[model samples]
Target: MSRLRPGLARVEFYAVWNEVSELLNQGHTYRSAYEFLSEKKKITMKYDSFRRHVKAQFAKKKFMEIDSQEKSVIPADNKPKRVVPATATVQAFDSKNAVPLSDLLTEE
Candidate 1:
């Protein structure tokens, strides 16, 4: 069923989203940001809703940063590849390469 959008929905925020984020990122308090923005343009959303909506932007920005960092970290196999430095040689060792306990206990 088609329904009419709410008053807040009628407010076009995408155009000013960047400015809103910049204001918050500059360390302005939510109250100050809300007040400042509301004065510049009519904001229908209540102060509390404005605070939550703006904070959600911060959360989204944080999440995106963490997600991008995670993407750059670790290979698909889950094991990180090591760079071979000339100072030291890396070796892969397993149980098959280990000396038997009996051999260690017995002296030739």
Candidate 2:
């Protein structure tokens, strides 16, 4: 019952869906599949329309579940674990007590 473009018949609709389903099943990203359909296959459909079709006929839940798992793995605190080496630590008093770099610059 859906209205398609002039050249897109019912059989073509099934064919396009078959291609979309195959690409998605093989773990292709939505953007990659969309680009393949548009650029290589010449499907010429808009983004939202393609997305709707993907959501309806494909494993959208799998993508969502994987995204949620990734989010949960990152800890709330973003602090680094290891302490910086004492040799690398800088002190103002050490610099003040040290011979001036200007003296070295003048001699050089």
lDDT of every predicted structure (CA atoms): 0.71, 0.71
lDDT, candidate 1, 1-108, per-residue tens: 233266443254555677777887899888887788778864645676677777677798899999999988957788767997687667877888899889889964
Q: Which stretches in model 2 have alpha-carbon errors above 4 Å?
A: 1-13, 59-108
lDDT of 2 by residue, 1-108 (tens): 245675454344456877877887899988898888778755666666677666755466687888899889988796679996678667567765687889889985
Position 107, candidate 2: lDDT: 85
Against the true structure, whose TM-score is highest? 1
Error of 1 at 39 (Å): 1.1
How does candidate 1 score on lDDT? 0.71
Checking candidate 1 for backbone clashes, the offending pairs are: none
Model 2 scores a C-alpha lDDT of 0.71
User: How accurate locally is residue 20 in candidate 1, as Cα lDDT from 0 to 100?
Assistant: 72
